[model samples]
Target chain A: MTYLLKQLGREWRFMLRQRYVLILLLCSFLVSGFAVFTGLAEVAQQQQTIERLKLADAKDRLEAQAKYNDPGSLAYYSFHLTYSEPSNLAFAALGERDVYPWKHRVRMLALEGQIYESDSQNAELAQAGKIDFVFVISALAPLFIILLFHDLIASERSSGRHDLLVSTAKSKYALWGSRGIVRFVAVVLCLMVPFYLGAMISSTGFLTTLLVSIWCIAYLAFWTVLSLWLGKKLASAPRIASILIACWVLLAFVLPILSDLLINHSVHSAKGGDILLTQRETVNDAWDLPVSTTMDAFAATHPQYADYSYQGEGFDWGWYYAFQQVGDQASTDMSNDYRAAAAKKYTLAGYATLLSPPLLLQRKINRLANTDALAAFEYEQDIRDFHKALRMAYYPWLFGQKKFDKTQLTSLPQFEDSTHNYKKVQNEQ
Target chain B: MNNKKTQFAIEANSLHVDIKNAPILRNLSFQVAEGEIYALLGGNGAGKSTTLKTLLGFNQPSSGKVFIAGQEVYSALDFIRRKTAYLPESATLYPHLSAYENVQYFLSLADIKKSEDELNQAFQRVSLQESAWHRQLQTYSKGMRQKTAIALALLREAPIFLLDEPTSGLDPVAIDEFNQLVRELASSGASILMVTHDVYGACQVADRIGLLRNGELVGEYDAPENGRIDTEQVHAAFAQRKAL
Candidate 1:
């Protein structure tokens, strides 16, 4: 053990002397910090946009109330905003967040159309991927592993020290094992220290954050083992290096994209765009339908209002919104099937974790950050439920059966309580 | 003849080694007795280094076996290695550590823990300058690195020493010093097996010399009965063998 520690100390001193290690480590840190700054900026900008839209919503509702002042009109015109707050650890592995929308505004119209609206973003940046802890573990850690291991025995042999060292009483296992442990610790430290700092700043939960750190360390260990095994097998340095780098490219880059493409092709999701087009057609076509026909359809769905009289109305608020609710109810099953198909992609990706740890960690981070595909799907569910509540609140007043006073307007369901329970949802997933 | 056969300290009964399907050493046989300095003289590709590696158990013989001190070397690698010391033609120490640290590290690997003063004395015996002992090996010259490796081999105190062209790259003064060291070690009953191309140096220090050509030992010469052997005659014999 003492000999191993001494050798490890020597390796660390050697790494410190190599200018490239210092340069790469500092560059990685800077890149991580820059990525975090961009992530925080992106989240803050979305939050601000939501706030502006909410204010506009309040102003537009006030203007409409000055003229219509009907609860049914307010329900039809007013839009509700929903958003997911970024998790602290999201900065470390910014996976899939860029591709999925985080903030959404939805009306009491057909829920399917409002749910699939993607946020505005540059496609090139999302493709370039995030420069986060996932990048550190999956991309840069392999390079460091190669640096430490490519010449383990070949250098000694070329310089003619292999015979001398191998002739010693020390067993082969002890010699190679010590060398590998030193390199593994050094490379793992280079990844974990910056991650720990990011976790501390972001106040990530203690246990989950440690799991992330261990996952990275284990990944580096796997590479270290591979390097030593190959180094022992091959007689030349460059060949070993090339083989290890090839493995890195296959595991990190090629396999992941291949998995995604296969999953997407296998499970054909319904055209979310087609759902939006159909919902828009259905909602707008209600205007042309006879009022008696629309009311009968709405009354069948909401039968409590079958006895209510629309005595003598010129397009009464109650009768106007009855048809809107009926249009959303028309396509509920197809909307759900669309969401389930999209969510199956995540389930398929979960099976891929056993094949590649980078994918495992990628999904783990998205699951933790609550910015994954499933979260977006659940947010759609929330939109559907809230749209149902909006109709139930206004059916009586829309038929001219009751007066919607100022108190009734203030009692509308705002999106305050919907933002809670992220941590619990992550645990369940 | 003195009516005597040298008692073998190290012997290869019949050694063969194949690396990547190419025969490096083929059906070779040699021996070094206790207190005898044996020089293995060969051309660049004549399997001198390969023979040394086989004896040291770095390369497993394809057929036949090697014996060290009357014990077979096949499955007793740990036993054979513990009793042997080796110095390659060109050695590189850790570039980030001082010469003292390099010596200490090798000593520890050999399971020898010397005090600071004892270690310094070992370094001094090798004629390593005190001023450069503390400097990192990256700043060392070729001769300094060789001296450091020599210091390590001496400190290990193994009875059998295998050197592959040990004095290949040294200057005249360093080579002479190394030759003197080899003679002293042999006189103290340590068996020295050195593979070399410098026939004259081998003649100066080696008790017996053998010439290897085309993966076969072709000539063996003992020292002259008179004062000193004619190194030029031995060279002529080697050149004649190469021509054949």
Candidate 2:
């Protein structure tokens, strides 16, 4: 261990002497800091947007109360806002959150039309990908490994030091092993320091963040071992650099896109558009159908509402709500199938972790941050549950002929529980 | 204590090396005693450099075994390397570092920790100018770089030294100084193995000379004991042996 430490010191001193290494290291640190700051700004922007939407929704509700006190009008027109706050680790990965919606405005409509909504974002920036901790770990960390290990053997030979060093009694394995370990540890420290800082600022939990740090170190070790394995065979510094860079490009970029494309084509999403179309048709057709027919359809699935069944002459809240429930039931099968297909895609992507270390590591970081596609899927599902609660809360006032006053409005179902439930679901998983 | 341990500084018994499926050295065998200076003479592509590399454990022999300091080469590579220092034709020191820093870098790899003054002393022994010792090696000439390489070798304190064409690009004064340093190192009990194409230079400094042709040692001459060997006759013998 002492010998290994000495070797590590030599490696670091060598790096320090090189101007290019200092420049590159400085650039990497600045790049990481910029990425973190930008991500924080982005997260803050999202929170501000959510706040503004909440205020707008409140004002719209106040205006609706004065003009349309009817329970059916309030349920039809009022849209409550909800959002998922960024987890502490979000600055690390910033995964699918860039493309997915964290905040949405939902009313008491059939959820098929609202659940697939996305955030307002520039598509070009999303495609270019975020420069977060995930990018630093999976992409740039290997470049650092290549820079450290590519010349391990050839530089000694070129300087005429190779033979003299090898002529000692130390085994070939120890000579190479010590050199590999030194490079691996330096690269890990370079990545982990910034990552730890981000976690500290974000207030990430200790145990989970430590696991993230280990995952970062282990991923770097795998690359260092790989670089050494190639170094032994190549025998030339420049060739070793070329081969490892090629490996990095393959693992980090090509494999993920190819796997996602293949999986998406195989399963077929049956896009949420199919559900929206079906629900809209069922809801709009209610005006042409007799009131008793709509009530009968709603009563079929929700037998609890059968006691209040009534055929009112004109614009009764009972008739209005019966049609809404009828619309939701119409698209039930398509919605369930669409959700299953998305879940299957996520499962398939998870399988890719076994083959690609970079993807495995990226997934681990995002999972720790609670910003991945899995969390997105769960959050959307919770939104659906919140919509169901909204419908149930207004059913008695809308259908049972009870009047809703300002006090009653204050006591109505809110979206705070859905936000809390999203975090709890992530923790449990 | 001159231990009779049969301490061969380097031993290559019938070693062969092949590069790109073409044989460079075929069935070469040689040994240098613990404290003697041996010079290798050859034309271009005559396998002199390859012979040194094979002994150093850089090139694994296709067929035979190599032993340095009684330990099998390539088996205990770092062990063997730690006890030997090498100077190539053009040693590329880290250009960003001063001569002292370059020496210190190698010494650190050699596992020798020295204070700044001790490192400066190594440079002084190599006859590097005091001002140049603190300046970056990139500003130094070939002779200055070679001096720094020698300083690094001296700091390592290894038992064996392998030098490839060490006097190739040096001025006459630098060459004379390097030869004197070589004699001092040899007297200090470091075995020196050198490869050079300069026949006259080899005769001036080498205790023994070996001629290589087509990857084989064709002739051997003792400079101090069996002096004034015919170079033309030796070249003829090498050419005739090449036909076989």
Candidate 3:
């Protein structure tokens, strides 16, 4: 086709002349551009925050190194910070990142209370939740599809060209098909140009960018096909537009909210608040118990510390740490239950993603960005593992009653990103 | 008359058209022979459009058949469509497309791809004015749009032409140019079937005029070659039949 190209050229020229079409395309481009810009901005802010916190952590530990000579005093005062870094492609889609806490400061205490302490995220999101590229595709794109295609048949008929064009066209199917595809390509270009640019500038993986572009094409095709089918079926432009918009509001906005409410109402998830309250109660109650009561429980778990000699237990660092460990152990079942509920919610949401394409794409973008609920869960796991290392590092000195020199502060455990492990986890699923 | 219709370019044999169980055209029979320009004249709801649509194979006739260029229309609909150039009453053109673009696009869509020069020539023949040929059709008057349709038909070069109320909105000068163009196309051996309300214009250009009433042809007139058509008599006959 030379003929088809010529036809497409004609379509492009036509669109160029249409002020409204040009405006729609430009507006969409700008919105998506800003989404990319701010998404990157958001990720950059997180990175900077993490860097600032690490510096602060270094200073805080150095100060505590001088203040607390005993290993137990240092463990009590040290606040180890853990954070999740944004993926390279996260700028294209900041799904769930706006709502989730990516960084937290945990002390050597009962961890069930420390794990769920999210920074105030919702108020910030409410103030700054501009619909990102994710919103553009899932919510706004259908409107554009309707605008571009609703009048395909009705306008031709009303203008009195339908009979003429239909009667003389080589293949009427080709005519309609070309028209739809021309607009579809235009819509895709309008949305994806900024996305590709973001992906490029982010230095995202080449194959990933290609796969995402293809995915964008298939998703846009679904809307395009729907618009064409309804456009041809309805006899008037306004009617077609109204119906498609109604479908958009229902499918994109209302249905998702409804299903979310339903899922929340039905699913019984362990409450982080409940776990925190219980863990705090258990930890406080340990202060009244005999040293043997706390040590025996702690020793049951850490038998290596069972032989530690406790003398003058009125104010012992070893005895204090033993109780802290025992309090964490006391809430072990509740913490496990809390994690299981979160995992179940994620699973339920994964299944719910099937019914709404917008939800499906949001989850997909979240997965690519490593910014989903699962990613947060993995970060928490990293925190848990790092907390264990921190405890293990100190248990020997606290049990043997050895001097904890200030130089040992540098040897304290730091959190590592478990993205590879998470990948294995994702792949196995 | 029956013996003379063997080489007909369009043939509607005992056609009865119904839409949703309501009859639109009843036992309609007519033929436009090769190189003939036939005008089907009727008031509103007289089934003139129905007859044209049935011939186009858009509507399936309850009984009887339509044959275009010796092929039964429904069986080889696309084949028949390739042979015909249709201009509906409104002369609709894409508002965002320039006159040249509209014509060129339709030509290409009809699979009659032509050079830019040929497309320009078609536009020029319609006398669409060189200045406005590249201007978007939203800036066009009704007559300009009609002329562009004519250019499209010229490019199509189809053997059969269907013009539904082709002159409903044209000024006198544009109508004269249109009549001249239709005559040229017919003289070059294209069969023309025009459904028109302007009985006088039909009388001026059509070789034969048939009047339809209540979905049936009530009056038919044939013009002798080089003879003047009596417009007054044709109008009187149309008005008299509608009164009954």
Q: Indicate which candidate wins on lDDT.
A: 3
| lDDT (tens digit, per residue) of candidate 1 on A1-429 | 776676566556555666665676666556555655665555556557756766776677677666666566666666666556566667676666677665666766666667654522345567766666676667777777776777788777776667777786466644556656665676566567767776777678898787776676777778877888898899799899999889888877788889988998898855766666666677788888777787888888878788766646476666656666666666666666776877787888889777876677667766666667776666556656666666566655666556768568665655532432442221100
Give interface RMSD, per candidate.
Answer: 2.7, 4.0, 1.8
Model 1 residue A323 CA deviation in Å: 3.1
Ranking by TM-score: 3, 2, 1
Evaluate every candidate with DockQ and list the scores.
0.49, 0.39, 0.68
**Model with the higher lDDT, candidate 1 or 3:** 3
Please name the candidate that would achieve the greatest DockQ relative to the true structure: 3
lDDT tens string, model 1, B1-244? 1212235878876677898888887677888999888999877788888888888777888887788766677667777788888888886777777988887767666667778888788788778889999999989898888888888888888898988788866789888888889988988999999999888888888888888876678788887653445698789977786787
Highest-scoring model, TM-score:
3
Which parts of model 3 are misplaced by more than 4 Å?
A: A119-130, A401-411, A420-429, B1-6, B113-131, B228-233
Residue A318 CA error for candidate 1 (Å)?
A: 2.5
Ranking by lDDT: 3, 2, 1
Residue A223 shift from truth in candidate 1, angstroms = 2.2
Name the TM-score of candidate 1. 0.87
lDDT of candidate 3? 0.80
How many clashes in each candidate?
Answer: 2, 14, 0
